[model samples]
Target: MDDRVAGALSLPEDWPAHPDLSLALNRMGSFDWDLDSGLMHLDRPALDVFDLRPEEYNDRPADLGQRVPEDEGARLDTMLVQALEAGQESYGAYFRCRLRDGSLRWTHTQGFIRRDADGRPRRILGIVRDASQELADSVARQELDEERRRRTSLVQATSAALAHARTVQDVIDVLKNSRGLAHLGAANIVMGLLEAGRIHLVAEGPEGSFVPGTRYTKVDERYPMSEVLRTLTPRFIETPDDFARSYPELWGQISHLGVTSAAYLPLIAQAHPIGALGLLYDDRAVFAGDERNLLVSLSSSIAQSLQRAMLYEQEHDLAEGLQQAMLPRRIPEVPGAQVAVRYRSARLGRDIGGDWYDVIPLPGGRVGAVIGDVQGHDTHAAAVMGQLRIVLRAYAAEGHSPATVMARASVFLQELDTDRFATCIYAEADLTTGVMQMVRAGHMEPLVRDPDGSCHKLFVEGGLPLGLSAEFGSLDYPVSTVELDPGHTLVFYTDGLVELPDTDLDGGMRLLTEMVRNGPQDIRRLADQLCESVDGYGGEDDVAVLLLRRDAVPSPQPGGRLRQHVAQNDPEALSSARHMIRAAVRAWGAGERADEIELTADELITNALLHTDGGAIVTIRILAGGERRLRVDVEDRSSALPRRRDAGDAGVSGRGLMLVDRLADVWGVESRGGGKCVWSEFLIPERFERPGRHEPPAHHELPDRRDRGGRDRGGRDRGGRGGAGRERPGGDGAPREP
Candidate 1:
C-alpha cells in the first residue's frame, strides 16, 4: 500500500516484478581491487555473491578462498593478469563458487581494467553475479539436442535393417532383436497384422502378457490396437491411470507388467491401415511433442516393410508349390528295402530351389534311389528339376546300367532348352543279392551307416555334372558297386544337407557323419531327425535326403549272386574279388570248403585280368541241385578260349588248370558271344542248403553283368578255396592263359 514520494514516478509494492527492475533482481555485485596495496574493497552485494558474511570478510581478495575453490580463484587471477598485460579494458569468466553448506553455485564475473601510462600500473573494478539459473537453462537445451540426435540415429538404423527384410518373419525378427529397437527405450514390442477384417496378433510384449481374447479382435472393438486401426490415428498414452481409464481391457491384463505408458500406431501404407504397432514402456511417460510424430513415422516405415514382406511371401509360396509338385509325389514302397525321403525349402530368402529326391522301382526286385540339385535357386531351377527328374527316371527304368543311366541323363540335360545343370547320385540295388551299383555326377559322396551305428563316407569316382559333363565331353561316369549287408543304411543327399556358411565341405561332411551315426535307428525317424537338424541351422540352401535301409533279409541261396568289374592289371580289383568269394562261401554254409572256393576264384580272376584286353566281370552264385553248389564265372570282353597250362614248383606263372581241376567237383568250358567262360563247381555241405529257397525254376536266369537284365548268359564257376561267411560281383566268360 506504500507510495513513493515525488520524483512523481510511482511503482507498485511488487517492484521486482517490473521489467526495468530485472538488473536488480539478477543479484549483481561490484568490487574494487587496488593492485598497489594488494587489497580489495567490496560492497554489500559483493560479499553476498561470495557467500561470505560481513564478519568473515577482510579487505583482501585472498580471503575469498573460503568461498571460491582454489582452482577457480587461480583461473580468475590468470584472467586478470592476461587482461593487464594485453592492455585490455575488459575481461570476463564464469566459474563455480562454494556456498556456506559446502555445495557449488555457478557465478559470473566481468572486470574493467584502469591503467596508468605504463599499463601495468593499474587498478581493477569488476562485477559478480549468481549464474546458476541461467546456466541450468543452457544445460537443458543441450540434453534435448542429444535426445533428438539419438532418435534420428534410431530411425536411420531401423530403416536400413528393414530394407533387407524379404519375409514377414524377417521384419518381426528385426523389430524384436535389432539394436535400434533395443535402444528405442521400449521395454517390449507388440505387432498385429490386419487380415480378413480382423487384427491377428503376431508379436506380443514381454513373456506372456498378451490379453486373452484381445489377440484377434475386430476393428470396432474397444482395444487400444483396434482403436488406432479403426481411426487410422496414433494413440499416445501418458500415464498408468490414463491407460487404465481409456482402455481398461488391455490395462487390466498388462498392469502387472509395470507398463505405465504406451504408444499404439496405425501402420498405414497407401492410405490404408495394413497393421498396427504397439510400443510398451514400463514406469515411463512417453510420446510427448515430436515423439508422437516419431512414432507415426516409424509406423509408416513398418507398414511399407510389412507390405513388401507379405508380397514376397505370396510370390515365394507360389514358386514353392511348383517345386513341391515337381518333386516326387510320394516315395513308393519298395520290396526288400525300406525308403525314407524328405525335402526342405530354403529359409533365408524368398527364392525357391530345385533340390529333389525320387524312388524308382525297377523290374526283378531292384530299386533305384536318386538325389539331385539344379544349378540356381528360382522358379526356373524348379522347372528344370521337374523335367530332369522325369527324363532321368525314364532312362533308369529303361533297363540301363548305372553308368549308362547317368551318361544318358547327362546328355539329355544338355540337350534341353535350358542352361541349368544338376549334380546327382543314382543307386541301382539288387536286394536279392545285396549288390548295389552307384553312379555319381559331380555330387557329394554317399554315406553308409553300419548296423552298429557307425557311419563312413563312400567316395565314388565321378564325372562332371549332368549338363556340364555333356558340354565338356566327359560323360563316362564310373559305376562303383557296393554290397549292402543286411541292416545297413545308404544315405543319399544333396549338398544342401551338409553345406553351411563359412565351412568347408570336409568339415560339413564330418558333422553330417556324426549326426547320421547318432540318429535314430528307424529309417523314417532318422530321416525326420536329419531334416530337423538342418531346419534348426537356418540354412540358406534347400535340402533333400533319401535313406534306403536294407531290411534284414535271409542269405542268398539258389538265386544269390555277386557281380564285379575288374579292370585290366587292377591289383586292387583282383584282391577285392578274392575277399568277396571267401566271405560269400563262408556265409553260404560251406564251412570246410571256404578256402578252396576263395582260392579257385582268385586263380580264375587273375587269369582273366592277365590275358584279357580290357577288364572282366566276375559272377559268383549258389546253384541248387541234389547238393548245394557254389560256382564262379569270369567274363572278359575278350572271347579267347582258355586251356590247361603246366607249371612246376619253380615256375612263377601258369598251373591255373591244375588248381581248378583239383579243387572243383566238375570243371568245364562254355563259349558265349563276345566271351568264353571257364567254369567249375563244388558240392556245398548238406547243412548249407536253405529251406523254402533251395529249389529255383529251371529257366531261372541271372541278371547280365553290364545292363543287369535277367538273362542266362553262360556262367563260369570257380570251385571252393579255403574261405568263410555269406558274401558278395562280374562278366561271364572263359578263363584265359596268363
Candidate 2:
C-alpha cells in the first residue's frame, strides 16, 4: 500500500480542498509518510482541518509554509525538524498557524518521522487540530475577573476620605466634597442637633449658604424636622406633594430653598441621639436602594466622629483647669505697697495665656514686685510662669539689690533650658527710706500716678531679656531709682494692657497715661478699671498688674548720727590700732595680756597695707552701751578669699591670719558680692587705761617710753610724765612686758 493512502478516500483529489494537504486522496483524518519516497500524505478530514487540498498538495509550491506567531512557530519548527532528521519517535505542540484565507488559528499537531533501515529519517508525517475557540474563551474569562477586582479596589479607596474626620461636620464634608466628590452635587450639607425641643443647626456645609435665622430657633414646638429627629426614624420624600404629605410644616421651607427631595438619618453618638444628618437633592426623582445604602454608611461614620469630638472637648477642659491652678489665687500684702492682678484665657478654646504677678516681702522691711509673661498660650506657658515666680521670690529674699537680683535670675533662666523665653520686671523698695529702685529685663516700664494726677513712666536701660544673653559679663542690668512722692501709685503690668494693633508703642504709653489720669484712686478699683477698658486692645492678650506706694518718713532714733573717724597710712593706722587696743585691754580687765594684744593690733594694721590692693582706712570707736567694747574695722575692696597661715613662719610674711585667729575671741570673713572682709575682735582689759591722745599713766608702764629719739617711748605716760627708766625690747631683738 502507498503511504499516501488511508483506510478510504472520502473525497476526490480534484475537489476544492485546502491547497497544502491531500484531503481527497486520504480520507482518514491522519497523515503518513513513505520512507522510500520521502513524501507525506494526510486523510480527508486532516487536510480539511488544515485547509489543504489533495491535488493542490501534490502540486503545491515548494516554498509554501505554515504561518504561525514567531516565538511559538519557531519552537514547533525546531521540535518537528529534530523528529524528521534524528528519527525521533513523535512530537506534539499547540501553536498559532495562519490559514490560506489570511486568518490565524491555533492548532495541535502530533507527528512522527519514518526511518530507513540504517536508523536514518527519510520522511515525516503529522496531524493538526484547530483549538482556537477554546483558548480564546479561557482568556476572555480571566480578563472579566480582573475587571471585577478593579471595581472592588475603587470602592475600598473611598474609605480614606473618612479617615481624617473626627466630627459630624468633618464626616459630612468628606462625603460631599473630599476625595473628588464635589462634582456629585452643589455640595450643600447641613448638620442639626436637638436642643430644648427642636432641631437647631449646629453646622452647615458650603459655609454661608444657609443663613440660620429666627425660623430655625430651638424652642419651636411644631417644626416638622424636629418631630422626625425626636422620633429617631429616617424619613424620605421626593416631591413637593410627597414632602407635604410626610412633613407638612417642613414642605414650605424645603420648597422655598428649591429642595425637591431629602433623606433624614438620625445620628446616634455613644448610644444617644445627639443630632441627625440630612442628604438633600434638587431633583424630584427618588434615590435607589444602593444610593441610600451609601448615605446610611456615611451616617455611621458621622456618629463615630461625633463621639471622638466629645472626647476631645473633655480633655481640653482638663488642660484648661490645670493651667488656671498654676497661677496665684490672690495678690499678697506688702506693708507699704498696693497690689492688683488680672488674668484671662482664650474664649473659644483651652488656651491659657502666660501672664503672672507677685508681691513678696523681704528682710529689712523691703518688698519685691514682679510682673512677667512666658512666651506661650497653653499649660506649658503657665507652668514656666509659675517656676519663674517661685524663683523670683527666693532670690529677692536673699537681700539682693534690684540689679543683682535680675542679673542672677537671668543666669538661672538660661540654665533652665526651657523652650520659651520670658520678660520680667524686678523692683525693690524700702518701706523705711521711701526709696524705689527697679530693673527691667526687656519689659514695659511701670507708670507712676501721683496724687496730683501727674503720670510718669519709669524706664530702665542696658538689660537684655531672660534666656537671650547667656554670658556672665553680659548680665549687667541697670537699676532705675526715684524718690517716689507720698501718696503716689506705681503700676507694674504686662504689655497686654497697653499694646494694640496699628497703634505705635508711644501711643500705647499715652493710652496708659490717659487711663491713670481718668481712672479711680483706689488701687484695686484702678486695676480693674484699666483691664476692663483695655479688654479689646492687642487681641486681648493676658494682663497682670502690680501697684506699689511709697510710705511716709519714719521717726528717728537716738545715737543715729555719729561722727566717722578714718585713718589711712601705715604709721597712723598702727598708732590708732595701739590706742584702741590699749583702751580695750583696760576696759575688759585683761591687764595680764594688754601688751600681747597691743603687739597683735600693730601686726593687723601693717598686714592690711602690705597684702591689700591699697593701704586701707581703719576706723576706731568705743561703744558706751551694748557690750561697752572698743571697735576697730578695716574696709578693703580686695576679691581674694581669706585663709589662715601656718604659725611656723619665723619671718613676718604670712602672719596676719595666724595672729588674728589666735588673739581675737571670735573671727570670720563675711562675703559680699565681688569681694570679702576679714574681721576680728578681742576682749578689753579692765586695768589698762583707755589711751589718751599723747600719754598714759607712768605707774602703768615699767619700760622706756622712747625709742632713742627722746620722743615718748613704745609705752607713753598717761599724763606726759617722763618715765625714761630702761631700754625696752624693741623691734631689733627687744622685748617689753606689761
Candidate 3:
C-alpha cells in the first residue's frame, strides 16, 4: 500500500474526530481509481454527489471516463497518465461533471497518485469540490459592468438631444426617441402642460396617448398626474395594486390600458411646476435610482423649452390680432366690379409687417383701392400704417380725386413724424363709365388685363414715397387714367409681390404679369392662385395683393320694373317704396344690394312726400347692359328739384341728399311734363361680357391752352396747370373747370 493512502485509511491514536471536520470532509466527496482494473470507487459522500445508489456502484465500480464530461474526462485521463509515467506524487484538474440526475456542476479534483516500483500508476485518490456557484457569480459581475457602460452612453446621448430641442414638439420627439428609456423598460411616454387648473397634453411619443390637446382637470386628486403636480415631485407606481390603492376611480381605466407600472415626474421651470412628464410600462418594471434621476433632469430641460414655446405662441396671436384689426373688416360691394384681397404674414418668429390694403367707398359711385408697404415690420410701423390708412380713407371719402388723395396722405404721414416712409398706389374706379384713375407714390405700377385676356403694366408717373421730406409739393402725384372694358381686371400689390432678395425688379414683374394673365378670370380664384404661386418666394417681407375685375353685363330681363304710388301725406308710402325696391332687386338677381337699395328708395320717396303737397309716383328699374344699373325715380308735382347742401359736422337733417350723393353712382333731377323727377342710379355687378368691345374714352379731349398768363382763350382762369379736362366731381361725361 502507498504510504499516503495508508495514512489516510488509519486514524491517529490522539486524533479527536471533530463533528465540523467530518462535515467538511463529507461536503468534499472522495474518489479512488484502480488503474489495473480500469474501474472507479466512490465513497458514500461521492455517491451522493453523483446522485447514485450505493448498491449499484459498490458491486461494480463506476466508469470514471463516462462520469465526467467528454472533453474534461479526456483532459483528466491525460493528466493522470503523464503524472504516473513521470513518477509524479500528485495531480489535479478542474472540469465539469454530469451526474446521473442529468445536471451539470463545475468540479475541481486533486489527488495523490500511487505507483509501483517502476513508477506505473496502480491507484488514484482524489477529492471533488463543486464550484458552480462561485463561477456563476463571476460571470454576473462582468455582465453588470457592461450594462453600466451602455446606460452611461445612453444618458449622454439623451442629454445632447434635449439640449438642441427648439420647439415643444421637438422636445417631445427627442424624449420619444430615447433608446435608453426603452432599454431601461419604459414603454410609453407622454408630455403635458398645466394651464388654468387643467392638464393639456402637448405631445405623445411612439403612439398617441389619449388625444393631443386632451385636457384633464388638475383638481381631480385621484389622478396620479394631479398628485404629481400637487407635490411637484417624482412618483413610481410599482404594480397595478399600488395604482388602485392610490386612485380607486382611475384604477379601472389604467388597468384597462394594461399599464402595470408607471413613473410621473413634474416638469419644473423657473422654480415653478409647469407640467408633468410620464412613462408607462405594460409589464411590471422597477426603475433604478440613477435612471429616475436622469429622467428628472430631462424633465427640467424640456420644461424650459416648453415655456419659451408658449410665450412665442401668445405673442404670435397678439401680433396677428393687431394686423387683422387694421385691415378691412369687409370688402365694399362696388357696382360693376368684384374685388378680392389677400394678406399673409412672414414666417414664424417674425414680427407682423405693415403691408396693408383697403377698398373704400368713394363718392359718385366710384371705389378707391389702396395698397401700401411701410418701411419696417415692427409694432411702430404697424401703428403708423393704421393711422395712415385711416387718414387716406378720410381723404378719399371727402370727394378728393386719386391724385389729391395721395398728395394729402403724404402730407398727413409727414405730420405724424414717425421717421418712416411708405410706398402706396391709390386708385379710383368709376363703375358707370368703366374708367380707372390711379396715382403712384414710389410704388409699383398697376397691372391691367384687357378683355382679350392680354395683360400690360401701366407705367404711371410716381413721386417720392409718403412720409419723406414734405417739400415735394402738394400736387406732386401725377394721375394716369385707363379705360377698363367689360371683363377687364386691374391688379394692385406691394413690393413683396414682385421683389425678392437678389432678384431683378423687371423679372419679378414679368413673373407676376404672366401669372396674372394666365390665371382664372374670376377675381377670387385669381387672387388665390397668385398668392399660391408666390407662396414661399417672399423671404422676410410680408405679401399683400388686391385684385379688381370689371364685371360683364348680364342678359336683359323680360320686364324688370316695380312701381308704387305714394300719397303726399301718408307715411306708408315710404314703406311701400322700400318694399317695391326689394322685390325688384330680388327679381333682377341682385338681392345682395336689397338692403342698401331699399334705404336709398326710402330716402327718395320721403323727399318727394316732404317737399310737395301732391301724391308722387315711385319707379324701380333694373337696367340690363354690359353693366347693369338700378335706377330709382321719384316724381312729384312740384317743380323744385333736389339739391345737395353742405352738411357740416353737426348737421343730421341735410345728410339725406348727401347720403344719396355718396351711395348712388349718379343722382340728378329731370323735369318731366307734369312734375320734377328725382333719379339715382346704382350699377349692378356682372360676371361676363362679350369680348372685342371698344372701350369708351374716360373724358372728351380738351383744346390746347395758349399759355397767356395761365388763362384760356375765353379768358377763363385755368385751374393749377396740372392737367386739362380733369374728371368732373360727379364723374359725369361733362367736364368741369379745374
Find the 10 residues in a row with the least total lDDT in model 2: 556-565
Q: Candidates 1 and 3: which is better by TM-score?
A: 1
Q: Determine the C-alpha RMSD for candidate 2 after optimal superposition of all C-alphas.
A: 20.7
Task: Assess each prediction's global lDDT (C-alpha) against the native.
Answer: 0.78, 0.60, 0.70
The residue pairs in collision within model 3 are 553-626
Better of 1 and 3 by lDDT: 1
Estimate candidate 3's RMSD in Å.
Answer: 18.5
Q: Rank the candidates by TM-score, best first.
A: 1, 3, 2
Candidate 1 per-residue lDDT, tens place, 1-738, comes to: 234444567658885464324434578878888989988887777788888888898898878989999899888889877877788899999999999999999999888888887667468888888999899999999988988988887788888899999888889888888776666678888999999999999988899797888778898888888999888888889899899999887788888998878889999989888999888988568567777777777778889999999888888788888989998887888867889998888874457788889999876456889999999989889999999999999998886767778889888889996889999999877676566778899898899999999999887878789999999999767767667888999999888878887778887888789999999999889989888887676567888999998887655557566665667766656665665666566556675676666777777777777777877777777885666878888777766666545577799877776666555555555566777666666776676343355775221232122112211133322222211110111323333344
Q: Write the per-residue lDDT of candidate 3 for residues 1-738, one digit (tens) a residue.
A: 699897788777747765435634656677777878867777666666555667656524434545677787777779877987778889887788787777787777788888888777788877766667767887799787877777777767776777666457767777777687778677878767888888876655334346322456564556777888988889998888888898786665446677888888898899888888888888756777877776777677677777876776677678878887888888888767888999876545438788899999865456889999888877777788889899999998887657668888888888886788899998776554455567788888888888777899877778789877354564456655555666788888887778766678898888888888888878788888777766556455677889888787444453244444566555544554554465456546555555556766777777777767777787666565655878888888876556556567986555676555445555566667777677766666664242344753221121232243434445645333111222223323222111
Ordered list by lDDT, greatest first: 1, 3, 2
Q: How much is the lDDT of residue 54 in candidate 3?
A: 71
